[model samples]
Target: MESDKIETESLLENLCVGLPTIALKADIPTPKWNTLNPYFGAEDITEIVDWPEFNYNTIIHRYGGILNSKKIDCVDFSAPWMHTEVWHKSQLDTRLDELVRPHIIRTLRAAFEELEPQTQQLNLNPVTFGHGTTAITIGLFWPDTSFTTVAEGYAQGKNRAPGVLGISPKWSSEWRHSKFSNDQHHFQYNQTLAELNFYMDGHGARCGYVLTDAELVVVKRLDTNGRLAVSAPIPWKTGGNGQLSVRLGLWYLGMLAAEEENWAL
Candidate 1:
C-alpha cells in the first residue's frame, strides 16, 4: 500500500508537469455567404443583408437551405451543382470550404499535437468533439483495454457510478427521455462539458476528472453551449511532488486514480 501511494503521488506530479497551458484567442472568422455574387440570389442576399457579420451557425443554416430548398435553382449559383432526385447539391466555394474548415481543423490539430504526447508514448488516438467557428470541443483518447479501469477509477472517486462524471447526467437523461429515447444514435454524444459547466458554474463546484493510464487528463469547458472545449493527457513521472492543482473534472479523476492500486488489493 505504501509503495502504491508513492507511485500514485509520483504519477500525479508528472501529470502536473505534462499538462500544457494554452493561450485562448478569438481568431476564427465566421463564414460570410452573402459576399458571393452569383451563388446567392438577390432575394437571398436581401434576407441576410442586415446581418452585421458572418456566423458559422448562420452560414451552415443557409447552406443547408441551398442544399434542401427546391426554390433555389442552380442557374444563378456559381459553384458546381448536381441535381439529385430529392434536392440540389453543390460544392461550397473554395473560399468557404478550404479557408474556413481547414483552418479550424489545422488549428485544432496543432493545439492537440502540442498538448498530447505522441501516441507511441501513450498508445491512444485523439478524438475531437464540438461544432462551430471556434475549436470549442474537448478531445479525448484512450486505449480500448483501459476503459473499464478508468471508468472504475472514476466510480471509486465519488463512491458511486461513473455516470456523475458526465456533464449533466440528469439533464442528459431528461433530454434523452423527452427527445431521444426512441433514437439511440441521438443519445450517443449530444451532451457536452460546456453544458455541464453552464448548469454547475454558479454553484462554486464543477466535476472535471477522468482516469488515464498516464495519470491525468486536463479538460477545459470554455462555453455554455459546448461551442468551445479542450482536453489532453498528462503523463506520469516518478519521485515528484503531487501537490499540483487542476480543474474540477481532472481533480476528481486524479483522486480516483490515486487510489487505483487499492482497488486491486
Candidate 2:
C-alpha cells in the first residue's frame, strides 16, 4: 500500500504537474514555468497540480529533450505544437485500453447485477461522452428501481467545463408516504439529488442525458395522458462497435480461470 501510495503520487505529479511544466518550458526557453505558459503562468499550472519544486524534477527537466533524441521514432517532440496533442492522445488511449477497460467492465457489471434485473439495463445502455454519464444515481422504488438523470450543463463563460446534474426517485410510494424517505439507500439518492440541485442552482439549466438501460416503470404524474413506454432492452452482446461482446468474453474468461484455479487450489 505504501508503494502504491508513492506510485500514485508520482503519477499525479508526472501527469498533472511535470508534463505541463515541460510543455511550458519547451514553448518558452526562459526556463521559468510561469513565463513559459502562453495562456496561464507556470504558477497557475503549479497551483492546479499542487506540486512543489516541479521544475527541478528530472522527468520535468528532460521531457522535451528526451523526446527530441532521434533514438525514439514514434514520439516526435520535433513539432512544438503537435507533441502534446498527438503523442499524448495515442499514449493515453493505449494505456487505458490495457488497464482501465477490464476494471471498468467488471465493476459496472457487478453493480448492475446486484441491482434488480431491469436495472441491469444500465449496463446495456450505450455510454455517451457528455455530462451525467459519470454522476450515476441509484434510486429505490420499494420492489423496483426508478430514477431521473440529467444530461449536461453549459460551461460558465465560453468553453471551460460544463456541470452535469442528476435527479433520482422522481416519485415513489416510499417518497410520497413520508415527507422524507427514511430508507438509507433511498435517502442516498436524495442526498445526490440535493448535491445536483446545488450544482444546477449555481450553474444553469441542467439537461437530461439520453436515458440508457432504463424503462419508465412508473409514471404517476401523467396518469390521464398514457402509460410510460420503455424501449426494448438492447442485447448485452450486440452493438455497432462489438465492445459489449469483447467485454463479455473478458468476463467469461475471468470466471472460467477463477473456477479452474479454485479447483486446483
Candidate 3:
C-alpha cells in the first residue's frame, strides 16, 4: 500500500506537469435553462463548440501525454439517453440526441484518437444508464476485469457476480429497512456516499473518467431533473484522506480503485 502511494504520487505529478490549473469555484449559481426555447439555440452550441480546450487536438494531446503512449479506446455510457422512450413519445418531438450529439462525439473522438491511435473506434453502449453509482461500482468492484467486459456486461444488463461491491440508490433504500442497515457494511456504504457527495459538491458538477487498458469511459453527472450539470476541469484529490491529487475526471476512478484496495483485508 505504501508503494501504491509513491506510484500514484509520481503519476499525479507527471500528469499535472504543464497542465492548466483550474480550481472549482464554490457556491457558483447553476445556469437557468429557458424552457420557452426548448431546444438549444445557436448561443448554446457556440459556447460548447468554440471552447478551445475541449477541442480535438488539446484533449487528445493532454490525455495521451498522461498515459504515455498507452493504446486507448474511448466509450460514452450516456448514449442511452439519446434513445430514451420519453423523448420518443414526447409531444414536442424533441430528441436529446439532436441537442448535443455532435459536440459529445467530437470530444469523445479527440480523446480516443489521442489515447489510442491504433484503435480508431469509439464504442457506444446504448443500454447502460451510467449514473455515478454505476460507474464507481464497475471501477471499484471489478478492478481486474478489462473495460470491454464491463461495458458489454452493463450494455446487456447483466447482474454483477456475487461477493463484489454493488450498491445503488435502490439498494441503499432497501438496506435502510434491513437489519444490517446499522452495521459495519452500512458504515462503509455511508462512507462511499460521503466521498461521492464530496466529489460532486467540492468539484462543482464535473464528469468522471475511468481509464483502463481497453477503454476510457467518461461519466457525466446529471441533475435531479435529468439535465446536464455544468462542469469545469478542476484539480481534485484522488486518494482517501486527501493523499494524492489529479484532475477531477480522473480522480473519481483513482479514488475508487484506491479505496477498494484500502478496504480489502
Candidate 4:
C-alpha cells in the first residue's frame, strides 16, 4: 500500500514538470487545497468517488509559489479555450458506464508515469450501438460527463502525458471484444495489445488531449492492436490557434480525466 501511495513531493514534481501555467487554480482557496492533497490523492478504486474534481480542485494547484503567487499571461478560459467545450454532446450518456467502466479500470490498472508518445491508432475501430433510431459511434462520441472542465481532467492521476487520442468505433468495439483476452502477457511479459485508455470514464475520452510547451497532441485509446495513436503535435504556444494555451487545454483534459469514473460506462 505504501508503494501505491503517490508521493506528494514526486506527484507535485511530476505535475510541475512541463505543467501548463494555470491547471491548478479553481474555486478552492489555494491554502485550503494544499492541506488535503497528500491524503485524498492516495485513495484508490475502493473509495469510488463519483466525482473526480472534488479531490483535484482541492489538490492540483498546490505546487507552491511559481503557480501560486505568480500571474502567467492573465489567462482567460472562455476566450482562448472556448474550443475546450464538449463536442457531440449526445453520445456516451449515463447509460453506457457498465460497458465503459472496464476501459477506465484498465487504464488505472495499467497506469504508469510516462509522458512520451507510446504508439499510434492504425486500426481505428468504430463502435455503433443503437438506442431508439439514434446511433452513436464510440470514438466519435462525447464525454458529456467526464470533463466539465479541463483542470479536472489534467489532474487525472498525475501520470503526466503528451498527445490526444480519439478512438474510432471499430477500435472501440475491438477494445470491448478484446476485454483483457491474453492481457496477462501484455504487462508482465512485455507483450502489450491494449491501447492504454487513460482516465476513461464518461465522455469515453473522445476529446481527450495532452500538451506541453512545444506541442499539442490529441491522444486516442486504441484497442485493435494494443497500440496508442498519438495525433501529430500541433504547436501550442506559438502556432496556429496559439490562443489554445497549454493551461486551458490541460484544464479541458483535467475534466476528461476527472470524469474517470463518470466516464467509460
Q: What global local distance difference test value does model 2 have?
A: 0.23
- Of the two candidates 1 and 4, the one with more favorable lDDT, higher being better, is 4
Task: Write down the worst ten-residue block by lDDT for model 4.
Answer: 41-50
Measured against the true structure, the TM-scores of the candidates, in listed sequence, are 0.20, 0.20, 0.21, 0.24
Model 1 lDDT per residue over 12-33, tens place: 2222232222212233233311
> Which candidate should be chosen as best, given TM-score against the real structure?
4
lDDT of 2 by residue, 60-150 (tens): 2423232123121121122234224212223333322332233323333342333335433432321112222232322311101111121
Model 4 misplaced regions, further than 4 Å: 1-213, 224-227, 239-242, 260-265
Model 2 vs truth, CA RMSD: 23.3
TM-score of candidate 1 against the unseen true structure: 0.20
Model 3 per-residue lDDT tens digits across residues 1-265: 3453322232223333222112222332333111122221212211111112332234334443544443223322334344333311121112212322232333333334443443323222222122233323422222211111133453332222111111122113222223564464344333332333234322233333322111122333344222222222222223222222222233223222222122111
- In model 2, the runs with Cα more than 4 Å from the true position are 1-180, 208-265
Please give the RMSD to the true structure for each candidate, in Å: 23.7, 23.3, 19.3, 21.1
* Model 2 pairs in collision: 33-42, 34-42, 121-213, 150-209, 151-207, 151-208, 151-209
Question: Total clashing residue pairs per candidate?
Answer: 10, 7, 0, 45
